[model samples]
Target: MSRRSLARFVALAAILSMFGTSAAVMPAQAADQVIKIGIDLPVSGADASDGIPTQNGAALAVDEANAHAPKGIKFAVDALDDAVGGVHNPQQGATNIRSLAADPAVMGVVGPFNSNVAAAEIPVSNESGLPLISPSNTNPTLTKTAKYRTAHPNEITYFRVCATDDVQGKAGAEFAKTLGLKKVYIIDDNETYGLGLANVFEKDFKEMGGAVLGHDHITANQQDFKALLTKVAATKPDAVYYGGTTSTGGGLVRQQMGAAGMDPAKVKYEGGDGISDAEFIKVAGDAANNSYYTVAAPNAAKSASAQAFINAYKAKYHSDIGAYSANGYVAAQVIIAAAEKAIKANGGKAPTRAQVLKNIQNTSGFKSIIGTFGFDKNGDTTSPVIALWTIKNGAQDFVHQINVSTK
Candidate 1:
């Protein structure tokens, strides 16, 4: 052979060694089409315990989807923090949604954990035709009332995986009765979610023949709840129900109960999903004992379909699932399912926001690790279920779960 022929043979041998014999016959793989899922939550401060796990759940879904996504598509998470000064801020949530909406690559968003934040972001997402599926927002007016729909009444872009406060509050009231607590005092954080949940709990508790000694509201981040606890102690109530989250005085109220001579051990404390966080326990300290809370979503740990998800979640995050973590996963599943449908209809191209939105709205009978359910016309979960939990030994312990009738 000539020198040129010998060099060519050596180069061919190197190529064969690099890729093996099948490389010559196999076609080149196409680059994956990237689709982004935006996550908006309070990822810092007191709420980080809940926010981080919720984001992890969604991120886990993205990881799984990317691993098994169609031959030419991939998923990514664009998580953005909507917390200002360590708490969830509505204005910040609105800004985050606007930013996500501006990104053509972001097909959907999962966030605004607090209901109040959801209220501010709904209008922006509606106008942008971007879907906001929440893992924890549970205020009824978000979907039941017309106030949030003023921007675009014809189009509903907000959805959630959890039951609304109306159902959760009623369930809590019923649970209180079951616990043989006849007299109760209610306190709220004077915010949209807290106040609304308190109102429902108060009304239902009264209707069930339970005495509501008194109801009070506290300012946000007030830091001092001694006066409120003093008044609550004077009532001699069997239980003190708080309608708020840890960041908004849920933990402080329980902790101050002891300072006001209302031993948390003797006086049972209860609250909604707002207070159902690890931060609440940490802040409440020894007073965390005897504190019972309700979650607006079904018990994922109890769901037979959820075992696999629980295993997968633990494997990825190396921690137990948070209250709304499964809800976050389900929310992401809804978005991914919708994206798949939209992409298929669009001939395998990146789907438009409107296309994704329409597909999301059409989601029905979708089965997830949590359960089989779908979005109703109002974009609320058809599975309106709530779970009860308590703090035992400074950690969360599942009590029981019940399904609430939305009708």
Candidate 2:
């Protein structure tokens, strides 16, 4: 059966008839089991542009999972907002995970796109043995921490389908090297993702034998970037790398870079996945052109599966897909796949939280719209590929692929 076929999932439903033969392993409340996957996202705030698409992709995955749910279990989603006033709040993210952990029905969670939010959410999720799978969190520290732990506990079960900032930032730096751009200035949004990405870029760019002019951090959602842009202009560097998202002043930085007389093409501009959203093009207008960004998800225009998702997404939401849509979809797929494996291992009985988490951590060769990928020992995707994009005509167009490594 085709993996993408929604009807194919109903085959699992057929297993319901066979469950009666395995009564010894069935849980006491098996008849009332309702499997749920919690979605924590910044659906209403600053990340709404990316968050909405992330949620849309996840919703589709949930629909498919339910269509294929095994007997005695009804699959559903318990989506919650982790945003406050349209911005990701670490505290809110933590609270959302705690609530999900408290729910007995929730089998796993997919969300908290922002890296800073994931940092807060991880500890809470680990405490309750809830596996938190992120569709967009890319800070390398989460998985790259010293053996057994970094800032988090050894029992942490956080995982991500997206490429971490170390890989993405290195791609950006390498792309800059190809452009022969020297003397680059770095600016970040002062958040976990942004700063972490900036640091990686700075290190990689310099290591590539390029000159690093300076670096600084900016406030999130600030309208005025003229002063910073002016400083960047004074340096007259070959490029300005802003490690931030559209919601975190990426557009203003792009716009002001142009307004400050920094030629978009000559000086060049680059950012990590944070600024790759359509909103960046909208917010920066003509100035967005010629800018560069890196994304973990493959280009939808090139992948057939991605094209199908794009069409379905447009039909359902009447909106174009975002950079993180495929990531979110795959995140849900991973969780659903793990749950399926756990269910089978339990002889058609519902699996425990630990079982589900273990299955996810050991996932390998899972196929999805973006392509086939699996989690390594660190709970990060085994795929080390990152796609680069360029802005043209107020849209992010796929440029090419870049293989990156993190030190």
| Residue pair clashes in candidate 1 | 245-274
RMSD of each: 3.6, 10.5
TM-score of each: 0.92, 0.87
- Model 1: ten consecutive residues of lowest lDDT: 398-407
Writing each residue's lDDT as its tens digit, candidate 1 over 1-407 gives 99999999999999879888787879888788889999999989998988999999999898988877765889999999999999999999999999999989899999879999999999998888889999999899998876887678978799998999888899899889988899999999989999999999999999999999999988877899888788888989999999988998899888889889888888999999998888998999999999888998887888888998899999988999999899898899889989988888878887887888998998888988877788888999887788999888888899988876543
**Model 1, stretches more than 4 Å misplaced?**
1-30
How large an RMSD does model 1 have? 3.6
> By TM-score, who's the top model here?
1
Write the residue-wise lDDT of candidate 2 on 1-407 in tens digits. 67667565676666765785687676676364678888998888557888889988888788877777888766788999988877888999989998999988788998988999988888777778888888888898877773324334666588888788877888898888886788899999999999999999999998999888989998755789888889889988888899878888888888878778798767778888898777788888888988888886666667877777788778888987777787787788888888888888888888888898888878888888877878877788887668888887777788898544332
